[model samples]
Target: MTVGSRRGQATESLRQLTEAVRTESSDGARLVANIADNPICRVTVDTGIPCVVLAWGSYATSAQLRFVHECALDLLRRHALHKILGDDSALAVIPVDDQGWLREDWFPRALEAGLKAAASKCPNGFFGKQSVANVMSGAPVGITVRSFEQLDEAKAWLQTVKI
Candidate 1:
């Protein structure tokens, strides 16, 4: 099959997976968006707070990274979120190429789109820590970035952010 056909098939598969995992409000959080397949990330709006929760899967490719960014951007546009709680504890490795794109391109766009504060739960291993470090180092001004080992702490910190 051609590359375009392969891409189309992949997209369809992701759509199906997203649909399978999609859920509405549960325990006060509302599902806003999700991207499945390679990266498998979901965005949910906290009904009790002005924050968005981003949960990432274990493995991710460059395409998945782009899709995650797109989904996050859409969520930002739809909700007036003051903080983002990024649960990257499952993320293992991020391709070096994708790292640069995230720092240089996606993050700037997110900041411009009104992302104010972000708290992330990072994986414990070297690769995951390094990936988070790279993105944190390159993050633009005006947004606060913090790393946490526990999801509860991350959420608590996000609550303290003024926006």
Candidate 2:
């Protein structure tokens, strides 16, 4: 077989593998939003919690963050979701620069979009947890953030948040 043909086959195989992984990962969740070129941030509406859920992949980029912010705001507006559950346990780290954008831009816009409360599964370590905590601290008044080690706990907390 020609070298170029071999390379084409390999690319197709890799694409199939990625699609398989994505299908398996999102098996139970209903996909609600997807941004072109930023498929890692899977936005779904959780049937169990009846809230919008942002499930992160292994890593996040600034462009992905922006996609997530915009998608979430759209979800909030369309569904009138008062609570958002961000499952960031799969995420490795929040970029230092994106942290400010999240705090100053995304968070406030979320509030204005009618999000009353949010729950995020804290990342696995002290530093990761601290990073999320720091961002949460700057959230606008009336917007509450609750951190949890488990998704169930987060969903439960979200259920109790008053609209």
| Candidate 1, superposed: residue stretches over 4 Å from native | 1-39
Q: List model 1 lDDT by residue over 125-152, tens digit each.
A: 7898898888888888988999998988
Query: Model 2 clash pairs?
Result: none
lDDT of 2: 0.71
Which runs of model 2 end up more than 4 angstroms from their true locations?
Answer: 1-39, 125-127
- lDDT at 72, model 2: 72
Residue 77: error of model 1 in Å?
Answer: 1.3
Instruction: Provide the overall lDDT of each model, using Cα atoms, as 2-decimal numbers.
Output: 0.70, 0.71
Clashing pairs in 1: none
Each candidate structure's count of clashing pairs: 0, 0
| Candidate 2 local lDDT, 1-163, one digit each (tens) | 9868955874575455445444544521122223422346677776566678887765654554555666677778788777789887877777777788889877876887798888999887666677788788888997988889997899889988777
For every candidate in turn, the CA RMSD to the true structure comes to: 8.5, 11.8
